[model samples]
Target: MRAIVLGGSFAGLLAARVLHDFADEVTILEPDNEQEHRTRSGAPHRDQLHALLAMGHDQLERFLPGLTEELVDAGAHLGHGEQVQFYIDGKRRPTVPGIRMIGASRALIEAHVRRRVLALPRVQVLPHRATGVRTHAGRVYAITSVTPGGDCHELPADFAVDAMGRSSRLGRWLEAAGWPAPRIERLRIELGYATARFHRGHELPDTVVAHSTPGPASNYLPSVCEPGALTAVEGARWDVVLAGYTGYRPTSDPAAFVNRMRRCVAPIQQVADLCAMEAEPTTFHVRDSRRRHFRELPRLPGGLAVLGDALASVNPVYGQGLTLATLQASALHRHLRCGASPHLPATGYFRRAGAVVDAAWQLSTTADLAQPHVTGPYPFGYPLVRWAADRVTQASILDAEINAAFSDVLHMRQHPRVLTRPRVLLRTARTLATHKITRPT
Candidate 1:
């Protein structure tokens, strides 16, 4: 059997790596020629900060042994949970031991994974622009692409995987091929982001700071790196977004950016002060969080699967996209290991992947909705849910147990259902009561 994976980034590479074990031959279709270092144009934010949560790291370690060691060997910093300080609701949570994460650029993580994937003798990387998929008699037979020489080629394969990023055209290709249109949900938030590398000095603390505003304010997620370098990302809704939603957009000027930094929590402000900018600002435009309901399609063609951002693109602020993709790859491995019929409909995989997407989507979209400017279909009981979340955030500030519980869910190590437990509810109630009792009268 032959398997052809589309896109060579994180998801596509992981899919190709796993497919090699099941298929007789595996090939990856990527447009870029260079693989030694991180390349932009294809993935513009390759040099930006990327966090690998415990869940993602654990999954990668299990799927690809010695992967973490490889990253550490490549100069990636391994930081424990206590070393990283989290500030939420204008209060800093006391850090605890045991929970840990890897801090590095998206390029570094991809480089490590790419090196391993390319090492497989059975796998091949083809540099070409994928045009479309050709299906015949209820099965996908080949992937058509245009080579650099201007020649069109049809690479026949037993199966094909789409790991293309946010701008994937698989939906259009499916529609052009006579497949029913898949349902798409797009929340156009019109957010803008500017990121720059900075050199950290001795005055800066070694930590990661994430500060999210309620609405119309900029949020920052900063990471301190080796050689006293740091990466800072400043994001806000755009002018068009300000006009459409609320008047809240971040400025591109350095001085204004510094002033806005003061609005965030203390730790982030401290980092913002100690670092000297090292690179030109790279800005990004965002359309709201999007998800395509491919699982609901009446008929999905056999021998084809879609993974990664091609499947669902979450708000990058949540840092859950890569982790969810890793989980989906793990799910694919399980399905193949059980000798499941690959030719059957992909509803099962879609449903499973949807679950992963839903968790992250809910967490991110809920936060987006909190911003006064963000407008969308209010999930049922939006007000109540937000109120409850706010209460939980308040409780987390005072209670260490609550902080740990919230952190676990935020890290994707535990499900959101844990937040609804009776014990957590009781703790939240007690914290609220205690706060009220101590209020000035």
Candidate 2:
């Protein structure tokens, strides 16, 4: 069997890696020719702080053994998810431990993953731009693209997968081919971000922090690297990201970015007077959170499928994209494992992937909509979710089991529904009844 993967970034690389197991030859079609694995110009967020959720971290290890160790060997920082200080609505939560995650620049993670995927003998990364899909009797057969020479050609494949990011144009091509465009759920989030690195050399900041505004104000997230973290691979001593939601956005100007980071920067730098900035700040923004409902489509060609952000993109602030993409790739692997025939419908794959996406979509969007400034339809159980989340926040500090459960959900290691178990709910309620909440002034 032959397979072609479009857009050779993280998702594309993962897709090609998974397909390599089932196909005789798997080709990755990408336009970017940058040889190094670090972030390319197409992915601007590479310079910002990034975390591989425990679930994705585990998946990557399953897909590529020794890959995580290779990253640390190459100077990437190894750490646990619980080491970071977490806050909800500007209120601090317990620092639970044991969830495994790695700390590194997003570019570094991509670069390492890219290297491993390209190493597979059956996998090839080609410099090509996929313009459209051509189908035979309603089944996808070939992809048309323009080579580096500017000459257009059609590449035949038994299966074509799209791993293009959020800006993918797959829907348009499908619509042009007489298939109705898939339904989309879009939430106007108006999220803004600015990031920079800082280090005092004498003191290495060791915790990540996010200070989300309590009421109408926007969300603010700032991070500091772990002490003794390997920085040679990422080329930065520390990584900091300042993020906000709604209309509140951090300025890109150095001084303005510093001001936005004030009171919300890393703990060691909270004094501001002590820590020194290392470089000018860069900015990235997201106008909305979007999810393409491909599973709802009445009919989809058998040979084509969408993965990662093309299927669903939520607020990056939640840091679920990479993890969710890995889950989707795993689902694709299972689907292909059942059958390698080109005529096999992708419905089973979409169904499995959608189940995974549903959990992430609900958790992240519910949190994003917690603030009133972001305009969007309330998901079911809105009030109950808020109440439980609040109680969990306060309860996690005092109750270790609750803390462990909440940490599991946050890391995507367990289903969000686990928090709703009778025992956990009872514990949260009891903790809330006895605990008195107070905020430091």
Candidate 3:
């Protein structure tokens, strides 16, 4: 069997890797030439903050052994997820001691994985853009793509997967082919944020630190600090991001960026004041979290599967995109590994991928909707879920077990249901009463 994967990104690369176990030929369609340990021009978020959640690291390790050590050796930082100060509404949470995670730029992670996937004998990359899909008898048979010159070529396929991120063309292709397009779910969040880079030239006091302020003031003041990987490959530089909700936002001026940091996290302000600026602040457009429910549709295509951002995109703030994509890849692997059929079923694969998206979507939307600035209708179980989440955040600050549970869920290592257990609820209630919870000031 042969498979066509669109987009040679983290998700696309992983999909290619997974398909190698089942297909005799796999081609990854990507526009940019793969580069090692460098930033990706296609994904501007590479300039922003991207942390490899504990679960994502674990999966990457499973698929590519010693991958974490390779990244570390290449100047990435590896440490506990709970190794730093976590603040909410300007107050610090009693730090939880031991949840593991790795810190590196998106390019670093993807480069290493790209090298590994391309090393596979069955996988190959085609530096071209897939323009359209040619289907027959309710199944995709070929894809049309444009190469370097003004020329078009059709490549036949047994299976095709979409990992094209936000600019996915599958929906358009599906509509043109007279097939039912996946139902899209959207949560509108008009977010404005600014990011700037600075170099310390020495070890940072902490690996990662975040501070968020409760609104009802001027704007949502949420801040995050992530130092570059600890190795000497990249200097002691840190990525600082500040988000302003509603109409307020940060400035591109280096001086103003530091001033914004002074108002949020403590060490961040010092890092800003002392370090050298790498570049001017880059503004970010926080759009809606969109999910194309392919599983909901009674589809016509038999060999089509959507993965990664092409399938669903949650709020980037949660840091679950990479993890969710790989989970979907793993699901694809499981489906292909099914021995009963020589061909993979589209509906079954979509449903499995949808389950992974559902988890991240639930967690992201629930939290985003709770914010006053985001305009969205109440999801299935709103007020109760919100109330419980609030209590858990507060309770986690004081209770070690609660904190551990919360971290586990946040990292996608456990289900959100873990927070609703009888013991957890009781402890949250107890902590809420006895602990002098400071109202969001």
Candidate 4:
């Protein structure tokens, strides 16, 4: 069997890795040169700080064994337990057992993953732009591609994947080929963030990761502390990022960026005061969170599947993109391993991947709705849900057990519904009540 994967970034690389197990030859279509570990021009946010949550870390290890040790040996930090800090409203949440985060830049992570994937003998990369999919009788049989000089060509495949990312042309390609495109749902966020790297050495010795965001005490505004995060990434460098919505969006000014960090959580502030800026701030803006509901389509071309940002692109602040892609790749692997035919539509894969997308969407979009400027196609009963969710967030800061439950959902290891469990809800209510009764006021 032959499989073709479009867009060879994180998601495309993972998809190719999975396809190698079932397909005799798997070709990755990516325009960017992968000869070095530097960020690609196509991915402007590659230099930005990125998170590999506990589940993403586990899946990555599962896909590329010994990668963790490799990363650690190469200087990437693995923050476990207390070293991985999360703060709400300027106060750190209670440390929870089993929590973990990998401190690495997106470039380093993608570079390593790409290297591992390309090392597979069955996989090869084609440096060309994928123009469209060619289908016959409701099944994709070939991919139309073009060269930099405008030469067009076709590659036959038994299976194909669209990992083209947020601005994927797959929907348009499918529509042009007379197929129904997945309906899209979007929530405009107008979020902007900037990341700057600084030389790191012996600073925050016990801390590898720190993230701070507005919460209940500040009414989800940056009144108490500006929302920011930082990690001890490779090359003995600290990668710090500050985020804001609409008018409060971070800027590229190096001094202002550090000043913003000074107002964030202590770890970020410490970095701002202690470390020398390695370079100017790199910025990226997010217009909205988008998801393509493939499962909602009545029919799709066989021998085809979509993954990664091509499926869902949520708020990056939540750090769910990479994990969501890994999970979707796992879903694709399960679908093929179960004897599901590549000659037919990947209904089962879409269904499984949809569940993952839904979970991430619920977690991110719900939080995004908290922003005052973000008008919502609000979820049913959002007011009540928001109240309950805020209480859970507050309680998570106070109770370790509740934090663990909340962390699981935040890290995408478990569904958000886990927070609604009777035990969790009861604990949250009791914790809030106790804290209320013991207030200094």
Cα lDDT for residue 339, candidate 4: 97
TM-score (C-alpha, index-matched) for candidate 1: 0.88
The TM-score values for the models, in the order shown, are 0.88, 0.90, 0.91, 0.98
Question: Candidate 2: lDDT over CA atoms?
Answer: 0.73
Global lDDT of each model? 0.69, 0.73, 0.74, 0.90
* Model 2 spans with C-alpha error above 4 angstroms: 35-39, 89-92, 200-202, 205-233, 265-273, 438-441
lDDT of 1 by residue, 1-441 (tens): 899998988999999988988998999999875655544667775654565667888888887899888877766656676555565434456575657777566777787788888899888898888999888877788999988787899999788889988788988998888887578787666666655555544543455434333321122112111011122222210111001122344444666555555555554466567665555355566667788888889878888888888888876666688888898898787767777666665566777778888887888787777765577788999887776776676677678898789888877888776877889989999988877522211
**Which structure among the candidates has the greatest TM-score?**
4
lDDT of 3 by residue, 181-278 (tens): 77788898766667777775654546554434442121223423321111112345666776665666565777877776776655566666677777
Task: Give the TM-score comparing model 2 with the true structure, all chains together.
Answer: 0.90
* Candidate with best lDDT: 4
**Candidate 2 residue-wise lDDT, 1-441, digit = tens:** 789998988889899988999889999999986746444676766666666777899999889899888888776766654446555434455666776567666777787888999999999988998898887676888888989899998999888899988888888988877777788888888877776666535354454333233321122222222111112124445566666654556767877666655555245235234456776667788888888888888888878778988888887766788999899999999999987565555888889889888999888877777655765688777878866765665677677789889878877888889988999989988986787754211
lDDT of 4 at 59: 93
